[model samples]
Structures are given as structure tokens and as C-alpha cells.
Target: MSSTATHTDDDLMTVPDVLHVLRPLSKRTFYRWRETGKAPICIRLPNGELRIHRSDFKEWLDSHREQVAA
Candidate 1:
């Protein structure tokens, strides 16, 4: 017998996963934003892992979109 598994959107990412997706931004830039208090707020799990919500990240990107009418 063969088995298959399905993955949900939430299952698609973790902090490092998100970082990998945003490759144009260096790791240093991510840390720098944290230090400067300019990064989108992250959530800290009970185990102390930091995570940025996918929705929040999308909102941040939308807000920074170019104003050009094209």
C-alpha cells in the first residue's frame, strides 16, 4: 500500500524558512533590524524560538510597495 500526506500553508514555513525565502536581505540585515527596533514584531514560543507571522510579513511588504501607478 502507498500513503500520501498533505501539507498546509502553516506547515510550509518556520523562521529559518522565512529567512531563506527573503534571500535578498542578508542575515545581518535581519539582525540589524531587530537591534534597531525596526523589524516587524515577532512571536516568541514557550521554548524561546522567534517567529514572524506570514501574514504580518505580507502586510509589511504591501506597505512598502512602490507608489508608481503602473
Candidate 2:
């Protein structure tokens, strides 16, 4: 799938999927953010895998947007 592809809220994104969108950022940093409550909220599966909802990720990204002077 292309990086620009849109995902529904029901779509669960894997770590690689997020890493794909957040290129140039390391997995270590991603985990660090997750640890510090700075990353998008995630769901832990019974098998101990993490999944992030598209909506939550979008919301997290939107929250970080810096308003610029027009």
C-alpha cells in the first residue's frame, strides 16, 4: 500500500505501518515516545503486539501541528 493511502478508524496499524508514515524516525525513538506518553495510544493484543488505530494516529498528528501566522 502507498504511504498516502487513507485508513478507516477500524483499521489497525502495525508498527511498520506507522514507521512507514514516520520515516526518518527510528524505531527506538518511537518506543521512547510511547514510553513517555508522547505517542499515539495503542492497543495491546493477547499475544503482546501493539496496534494503533488510524483515527488516534491522525488525532495525535493533528495535535502536534504548529499554527503559523498567516
Highest-TM-score candidate? 2
Model 1 C-alpha lDDT per residue in residues 22-70, reported as the tens digit of each score = 8777778887887898766677789977777667776666777899887
lDDT string for model 2 (1-70, tens) is 6779765888999988899999978899999999999999999999999999988999999999999999
TM-score, per-candidate, Cα-based: 0.65, 0.86
Query: lDDT: which candidate is best?
Result: 2
lDDT of each: 0.70, 0.92
Looking at model 1, report the run of 10 residues with the lowest lDDT sum: 6-15
Q: Which stretches of candidate 2 lie over 4 Å from their true place?
A: 1-6
Candidate 1 at residue 62, lDDT?
A: 75
State the displacement of the C-alpha of residue 35, model 1, in Å, after optimal TM-score superposition.
Answer: 1.7
Query: Candidate 1: how large is its RMSD?
Result: 3.8
RMSD of each: 3.8, 3.2
